[model samples]
Target: MVFTLEQHDSSKYRRKARMISIAMAGQLVIFGMLFSMLLTSTFGNSLWFYALGIVLGLLATSALFAVLRERPWMAEMRYVWQLRQHLSQISGFLPTLRGAVEEDNRAALDIVTFYHAGVAQLATLNGRTPPEDAAWLAEAKYLAEKREALGLPARVERFDSQDLQAFKRS
Candidate 1:
């Protein structure tokens, strides 16, 4: 049973965050260079003054970036933003699948099956699912085993709360 839509890998989000950070760093470097140049021009031939200005600007910018990256809120915002993008892509399918599960529609069942199979493949690729995904893994494993035993292709079934709980208990 797939509980969530296919999300871009966490690595993708991390890379995006890193890219944003790099862009910000570039902006900081540009600001620092501009500030240093302005100070050098204002001081008019004082080498010490220009050197101090450059050092101060670099230090200030580094401190600012350190704070930005270390802030809990910044990290949370990045993660949330990435998740939102992922969900938006598949959000509509969720309700449709859920409704089908509720109504026992065959088409919906097929969709759900396909979705889980995709998720299972991802999980396998990732080496293991996250802790929150334990239940889904269990269900997938069970269905796969059952299908193999029966010599039939496996179909993903909707996992209700009861089904998840039963899987966990075993």
Candidate 2:
């Protein structure tokens, strides 16, 4: 099976992005107010002190937003980015798995198991389906059954966040 980059719905992405930006702005404002209060308690309430709090708050918020943008839980954008990266690489690995399954190659079955589990895990996390998911599942199931028929263990390990992280590192 061939894999291709699919066009995502821009309207949905834009709506989510706007919501995240608003949340970040609200956090910044709250942080600034808290900082101002802290400054007021520590030192006398002065214009310069309040101004310094706002400046410091803005700097802190900027740094936090930069880091949060890359976090998977922040607005699902990072999840989509990671999913795209995985999908791009899958095309290259999939053909080998397909051949391995067809040839009943035991060594390659490990690769097939890992790839299938990883894709399944990513799809669940992203809340969306990859284009070839159905075909991939069918092939994976066939491979599992073939393994069983040959008196081999058919249990494929489920992939999780840690596995994904490890895969990314490699």
Candidate 3:
């Protein structure tokens, strides 16, 4: 998938995330309480019964929400979930990406560029510093400079996940 450079309003996304969180928390609590009451017959009013009921309820709600999140109302939540996954996958290949850079691999360069830009955007939205190593920060800075020095165009707005095929771990 290609990453877009559109600016996201943090408050808007935060509200969306809060709504989904509230829904899930409500489900967890409601299910937990109802199941705990119902399971008293099979397991009695013991800690084990309470524990088992809560676990089952949690499993049920988790599964339910996993499917529910696909609906249009959950767009913000889904986008955030996907963005985090992309960041993690990109991070896992940092070493290989850095190495690939020396070889002038365009795909690796694109992935790295997307990673830096995306994290910075996320950081802005979350009101925090971008979580990255000094080495990575230096590498990102150096890459931009070198690219500009060579008059190569920046491709920060769009990055394809398929480009990550080159960095798969054995």
TM-score of 3: 0.84
Candidate 2's residue-wise lDDT over 50-153, tens digit each? Answer: 88888878988998888878665554565456555654565465666567567776655655665665565556544556436677668877877888887777
- Per-candidate TM vs. native? 0.32, 0.41, 0.84
Name the weakest run of 10 consecutive residues (lDDT summed) in model 2: 158-167
Ranking by TM-score: 3, 2, 1
lDDT of 3 by residue, 1-170 (tens): 77565566778888777777898899998898888888997667888888888998899899999899889877766666777788898898988997987787777777888888888877866667786788767977888975676576765777678788867852
The lDDT for every candidate, in the order shown, is 0.54, 0.64, 0.79
Which stretches in model 2 have alpha-carbon errors above 4 Å? Answer: 1-88, 129-134, 158-170
In angstroms, how far off is 115's CA in candidate 2?
Answer: 1.6
Q: Which 10-residue span in candidate 3 carries the lowest summed lDDT?
A: 146-155
**lDDT of the structure predicted as candidate 1:** 0.54
What would the TM-score be for candidate 2 when compared with the true structure? 0.41
The candidate with the higher lDDT, 1 or 3, is 3
lDDT of 1 by residue, 1-170 (tens): 23333344556545656786787777667766777788878877677766776676778778777677767646633444433443343334655554644565444444545556555444443456633467766755654564566565576433332232322322
